[model samples]
Target: MSRPPSNTHDLTFYNGHWYVPSPPIVAVLMMPLAYLVGGKNISTADFSMFFSASNAVLVFLILNKLVDRQWIKLPRKSILWLVLLFAFGTPHLWVGISGRFWFVSQILTVTFLALSVFASFKSWSPWIVGFFIGLSVSARPNGLMSWPFVFAIAMQVMREDGQTIDLKKMFAWSFKSAIPILIAVLSLLWYNHARFDNYFDFGYVTIDGDPVVVQNAKTHGLFSTYYIPYNLRVMFLYLPEIHPDGPWPFLPSGAGMNIFLTTPALIYLVRRYEGRWWILGAWAAVFFNFALLIMYHNTGKDQFGYRYILDALTPLTVLLAVSLGKKIPWHFILFVVLSIIINLYGANWFMNG
Candidate 1:
């Protein structure tokens, strides 16, 4: 009993055909690179490194844009630190270098998330925003939650400029805004239908010989009340035990540690945000992912610090920057430094392991 054409990351094999459970945009983008490098012999680790490094640069650019627009005023040093921490102080570094299909897909989604956030601040056209968001969804289904946040920001900007949304204008704008998103969605549907003969099947639940997946499908489904506890542990409370006999003094791998352990700066997000409208929009986006992931079957398995939460990093970073109190809290700085060190160790461990 075997499945043919054996790269099992996102693809599902059924009825003598190959199908990708996730949307195909990422694969489409990689096709050219794969072709150029002689597909059979290319190294995914190399592409993963490229995508990760590129995302770091993109975040640097986005921070620069924010400072230039005076969206959030801070010293240049602070901006640099924020960028560095985001790049190295989270799972992005590890996942980017891991070079697996799952990690690469996340890298793609984060790129679009960065673009969409930048577009929102720059007051770019809804078409541009929709285009990026559509790409985000095509990269990862969880990315669909970003649309409302982007649209809300657009609406807030209009209100500040003394423009209101009336019935006619709202309907016209909604239709215009939906065009690109509709195209992406329809394209994905067509792709799925062609592969699996069903428009709605992503094949996640039907993964071959996965006991957890089978149980999840038959019992509580992909998302349900049963998943919250495991998610809570991985997202908030799970800690690696001291294993002096192991490779490093802690558990080398399996499940994941809490977010606070990996990136302490994100703890800032836990506090109440009494700030601008965009801050709320960002929080809303994070909450949407929080709720969704809380019920998901996997905790972004075999990773460091809950890789699933990577989708929320854009909003989380926004919240982190906005919530920084004046005077550059030294304790916070120490916490962030510790976070960077921890993640660096974890990333190295993950890459080698």
Candidate 2:
């Protein structure tokens, strides 16, 4: 829907001129805020925060339920701390205050994923989870692989009752959950076809003026094993550059910062056991989505922290909660505090830059 200048990046070269990627769902969501501020795009800086706040609430609710059900017990105070951690101790902090287009969509995906998880946790209708996944993929196609979450929740009943798998019930649940997802995938294919006359193309190859990405797309193709080293470095090994004299001493490289540095608390993920089927399913879901993102071209530019990591943040949170178990240890709390400080620095850098 956006028709910017020809040189502007992220536009698909269509039949003639440039066209926007994906419809303006974020713009429509921000309509009320725009009207409140006399209809200025500038007012959208708070739009991301709206979803961020919703996510905080969702996290709190999820944690509280886990405690109540004794799935992963924690004190009330610990719940509040984890909620704060998700809001400020992670990349969501940098994403929350940004008015930029990509940030808005990323934060919305965070919220949508959280809502989908919340629905599953509450044992609500499986369709709700599928519907939210449909919404999530609309925001970011990486979410298309979130289908495992549907299966995870669908099997919750059997797991809770300690019953053996029933193929017929499983098939029924799979059928119900697949309806919205099929709609989303078909709709996305149709949108791509309408734009570029190619059902499978999302126009990443036509991105304007990015020679490195284009070269990589040509040499290694759009998604290839060649990108794994670079993506792995950025996702885990890359660190901030030391500028002894610059006002900001440790600046993240343009590709993005490592997740462990920004949120070291995530390292607790290894502590997440796979004793439960749904928990294993959660890991599968996140890794399934992450595998596609890690292999894709472009490591996200002009971002405060690793934005792609946010895709699996919700499932990771579930794992984190499980890892915490009955008590919140001092070191985990310290890791979370340090994470908040680091992300706060990131938010400052992005807002000022």
Candidate 3:
């Protein structure tokens, strides 16, 4: 017998969530195949499957490019191990289908970062650079916050091989890269205006005139005044919690485990790769997350663990993969296994919860 249509708002389904719809726009763009198989029932969890899978593929490609560049190298076995690790290690890979925007945004954001890295290595046309940057911003408005980091990287590139920046060349490059950003901003404005009659309505921002409430809404609960200190204490002490009615399984509690466990390799990379372009990218990722946390805390509505920060996980993963290839022995292989185990446990916890 055909089952009755389930409640769309059930945690298992997509219809129950509350957020601006911009993320769905990007999710649909990235995974048109989801629409074909699940049609309109493509719940947030369903989209997460697509997003996480896509991210896995992109991470491999990005790593391949990095390997070829000699930034890091690994044996075939190690490469296999690393790939497996990333594919299974992160919790998002396993339980990300809960209809969260973080998985999709993270994939898009990381892809943009990879493209930017590629562009920095080659002499790409300004239009191309601009387009990618614009796409990055469109994927998430917070992406615009990374512009300074991008500029810093570009400046570093100009100083390539100890050479000085050529003013004319720099101007031309900067102008070209600005094109996509301008387009993205204008497009975002147009989208907002169409939906909310303001170029910057951002949905949640319109809930209340109070900046605190609006800002907290954006983080989904990680940085609210009450939750921030509480969560931070948990994270610092290595304690994980589970909330029955939380957005996702084991939230706030298991979520901290995710950040704490994965961040060590990232920290190691930053210190080891200091002054390198990759290090700058890592710093950008950190800056982006910290800024979001601060914004969320100021807003005072702590709910989720600021899960939105997951958007930066891609750059972090890439940085770790590359950096591990350098310092730890067979690091890729070992890390991958660890990541898979962690993700598996997290997923299992979510399913049971």
Task: Kindly list the per-residue Cα lDDT of model 3 for residues 157-229, writing each as its tens digit.
Answer: 5575476777786687778788888977887888766666667665553342245554555665424555566
Q: Please list the residue runs of candidate 2 whose C-alpha ends up more than 4 Å from where it truly belongs after superposition.
A: 1-7, 27-42, 157-165, 272-274
Q: Rank the candidates by lDDT, best first.
A: 2, 1, 3
Q: After superposition, how far is residue 108 of candidate 2 from its true place, in Å?
A: 1.3
Candidate 2: TM-score?
0.91
The stretch of ten residues in a row with the least summed lDDT in candidate 3 is 8-17
> Each model's TM-score, in the order given?
0.90, 0.91, 0.69
Q: How many Å off is the CA of 329 in candidate 1?
A: 2.5
lDDT string for model 1 (1-353, tens) is 34576565445677776565777776788889788877776677787788788777777777676566556666556866777778888988788888777788899899887887777667788788888888988888788776666766666666666787677755655576678888888888887778778887677766653567556766887788798998898888898778888787876346767888789887776677665666677878988989999998777767878898789887777667767744347777787788889889898778675
* lDDT top scorer: 2
Task: Give the 10-residue window scoring lowest on summed lDDT in candidate 2.
Answer: 1-10
lDDT of 2 by residue, 183-296 (tens): 877888898888889988777777664689877877787798788888888888878888889988888776788888988888887763856766777788888977887898
Global local distance difference test of model 3: 0.55
Candidate 2 C-alpha error for residue 326, in Å: 1.3
| Model 3 spans with C-alpha error above 4 angstroms | 1-24, 27-48, 73-82, 94-96, 99-103, 119-123, 147-164, 205-238, 241-258, 262-267, 297-306, 325-327, 330-335
Candidate 3 TM-score versus the reference = 0.69
In terms of lDDT, the poorest run of 10 residues in model 1 is 1-10
What local lDDT score does residue 298 receive in model 2, on the 0 to 100 scale?
Answer: 78
